[model samples]
Target: MRRFRHFTSSDSTSEINISPLIDVVFILLIFFIVTTVFVDEAGVEVNKPRAASSEDLEKNAILIAVTANGRVYQGGRNIGVGGVRSVIAALLEGDEEMPVIIQGDADANHGTIVKVIDAAKIAGAKSVSLATVK
Candidate 1:
């Protein structure tokens, strides 16, 4: 007598196909990363005033800057002193809650900073703040 053995034409394996799931996860991650928006920097060289009591500000502010040479900037654009009102007004036209922050260089003229602050106020910015370093 000969021993008998079982054989099948089709082979079966118990394995889960997770390649599509992983691809979907990576796609979602890429979508989120592409859609996310971070705080936009003013993109200007500034010498912020130092303060032991300095505090962090919430993100998503309209950043303006006053340089040591009395140059005014909004998002790195040279908006002259006389242009602050119009430029800031345009920026705040439809956005009611967009806060304004002025980052004044330590050596910047105090009067210039004051003027910039005043302009921001005139532009209907309810919350205006100054930027400083610790």
Candidate 2:
């Protein structure tokens, strides 16, 4: 005669409830998304001029780029000098205090850079600044 016994431990069947953990993760994701600060990028890359007194400006700004060939760019498109005003104006529609940062290439014509600045100012931007490498 032989006797066989089967036993199941309650601990072996217990599962960790991860619903709360998933909720926590979702909450954190939402928090980061809500608090994240996004920067407006200039569409073109430029060789920025060096500056002795260049200081950090606000992160969220209207970035306009001036290339070495005297082309103006914003959000990766060639806006040119004439498009600068309309672009800036549309971007600043809600925030009047939004700054305009011009990233001018070292070889870009000074006059072209000046025209971009003037256009930004005319678009009603309160703070217009030149972006330079320190």
Candidate 3:
């Protein structure tokens, strides 16, 4: 006499699918990046004078800086007095109504500031505002 035996086993493992989670994370990243508002900086720091009647200006305007040594700067580069007109004009090519804001140091020469203003005006700036600390 002879005997034979046969056995069969079945086991299944399940895993958590993270594809949806990854997709959601990517969507959130894109949403934050699209909603972020970037601001333009003047690239130079000046000792802005205090003003009693200073008002808040728009964040999307062009910024120019004049150092205490009467040197003109735009975006951290020394553009000089003669370069103001050309730079401003180039910036205002498409947006003629954009306002120009000047940040003059507390000890900056008044004449240099005036010249900057004049150049900005000639460059077709709709409005020019002085930056001051409140």
**Best by TM-score, which number?**
2
- In terms of TM-score, how similar is model 1 to the real structure? 0.77
Better candidate by lDDT, 1 or 2: 2
**For residues 51-77, what per-residue lDDT tens digits would candidate 1 score against the true structure?**
888777765788888889999887778
Ranking by lDDT: 2, 3, 1
TM-scores for candidates 1 onward, in order: 0.77, 0.87, 0.81
What is candidate 3's CA lDDT for residue 55?
95
lDDT of 3: 0.91
Can you write out model 3's per-residue Cα lDDT over 1-134, one digit (the tens) per residue?
A: 78777665456567899999999999999999999867767888899999999999655777889999988989888999999999999989988888999999999999999999999999999899999999
Q: Which residue pairs collide, candidate 3?
A: none
Q: Poorest 10 consecutive residues of model 1 by lDDT? A: 53-62
Q: What are the per-residue Cα lDDT tens digits for candidate 2 across 19-109? A: 9999999999999999999876897889998999999974688899999999999999998899999989999998998889999999999
Tell me the lDDT of model 3 at 78: 93
Query: Per-prediction count of colliding residue pairs?
Result: 0, 1, 0
